[model samples]
Target: MKIVITGAGGQLGKELLQLFKEEGYMVFPYTKQQLDITNRAKIKEMIEKIQPDYLINTAAFTQVDLCESDIDKAYLINGIGPYYLACEAKEKKVKFFHISTDYVFDGEKIEPYMEDDSPNPKTIYGKSKQLGEALVLDAYESSTIIRTSWLYGHEGKNFVNTIKKLARHSLEMRVVHDQYGCPTYTKDLGIALKDLLTKPHGIYHVTNSGSCSWFEFATEIVTFLKSQTVVIPVSTEEYGLKTPRPMYSVLSQKKLNSNGVSLRNWKEGLHEYLKKEDDENGH
Candidate 1:
């Protein structure tokens, strides 16, 4: 299987690229600098040249707060970019996979969100991502859209790394406890993505099993590392985030399970991730 992946420099993109390469598939990776998805001409030219079996887009303006200030950039990258890519992929008859976020839904639901859940985005980032999903599906009905939450990977700036850094520097860290979501490891998600290759094309919610607040997530990391940092739980209001996030963004895994694909629990994924960090650092 030949796959062309955009945002190859990102945590998820990097993990996917490595996974595909290790699986012995012909993989082509493009960073945002190399292949701007917003540029329709460039996207068309590249898709024609690669003729990939699958085109996975992990590119997006993911900064939740910054997205609010940069509305145009957010819409262009997070919304229109996927649409442009989907159009090109459709033209070439290439199977397209676009990564989406849990932010698409409002935090109104207390239960896990299914694939069919209606999105009522509360922030610019969420609104932009929701638009991207709609546009992609509208452009190509056969497109596969994967919605994930609280993703972390070894290759880039993610919550895990951020927490680790904070633990090392600060004695106490305040994390928002009110916001809840599944913490997904990019590597695990990459493996699941491979399994979805032969399945039906549609939106799939893929995340590590179980959910936790940001405080709990950070506490896990500190405990694993045996750090002295005190993790204090804070509410969303106390955290004073400039942008609002879905307080309950746990996406359901029923669709993925029905398709014979499920990832390990968040704690397990995080433990392995930290172990890898330890190994790399010669701890």
Candidate 2:
């Protein structure tokens, strides 16, 4: 089967490319230079050329703070881009798989968020993603929207890499303890997406089981690296930012479970990611 992945240079897109290649599928991974998703004409041109059976969109304007300041760019990339891709995919009779985020929720619920939960985004980034999800679902009934959270991998500028860098260079670090969510390894998510492609389509929450605060995640990184860096736990007020992050964005995997596909715990996935990074960098 022919598969097309947008944001080919991003961490998740790269992992998907690797997984698809290993699975012996004809995969066309397109970076921003190859095909700009925000441009509807370009998106149509590329999809027409590839004529893929599935279009897995991993592209987005992910800078949360930047999105708060630059709402236009955020909507263009995160909202309109996915809308255009879904329309083209529907016209071509291809299954569209659009990756979304847990930020779609307002973080008010104490329990894990189920798929049927109504979204009340508190940030511009979250609002944009919610718009994207709505557009894709409205345009294509066969589309699969996977809402994930705290994504990281061996490659990319993510929380794990940031913590690792700080541990390597600084004597101490302050991380937010109030905000909580599941940390998803991109490679595992990539494999999960590949598996989901073969199954029935619908909305699914695919993240590694379990949740943790940024402080806890940072502590784990320091422990794994055997670093002496002291990770200080701080509340959200102490680490105040322009964008208001979800205090609890833990997604329930009951939907993926119902589909008979769920990933392992976040810590286990983190261990494998760290090991892979160490091996690749000759650590």
Q: How good is model 1 by TM-score?
A: 0.99
Clash list (residue pairs), candidate 1: none
lDDT of 1 at 148: 94
What is the per-residue lDDT of model 2 for residues 6-105, given as tens digits with 9 covering 90 to 100?
A: 9999989999998999999999999988889988999888888889999999999999999988999999899999999999999999989999999999
Candidate 2 residue-wise lDDT at 76: 89
Alpha-carbon runs more than 4 Å astray in model 2 = none
Query: For every model shown, what is its TM-score relative to the native structure?
Result: 0.99, 0.98
- Candidate 1, 1-283: lDDT as tens digits: 8899999989999999899999999999999999999999999999889899999999999999999999999999999999999999999999999999999999889999999989999999999999999999999999999999999999688889999999899989999999889999999999999999889999999999999989899999999999999999989999898778888999999989998998999999999999999999999
Q: Candidate 2's error at 9, in angstroms? A: 1.0
Assess the local accuracy of residue 97 in candidate 2 as a C-alpha lDDT between 0 and 100.
Answer: 97
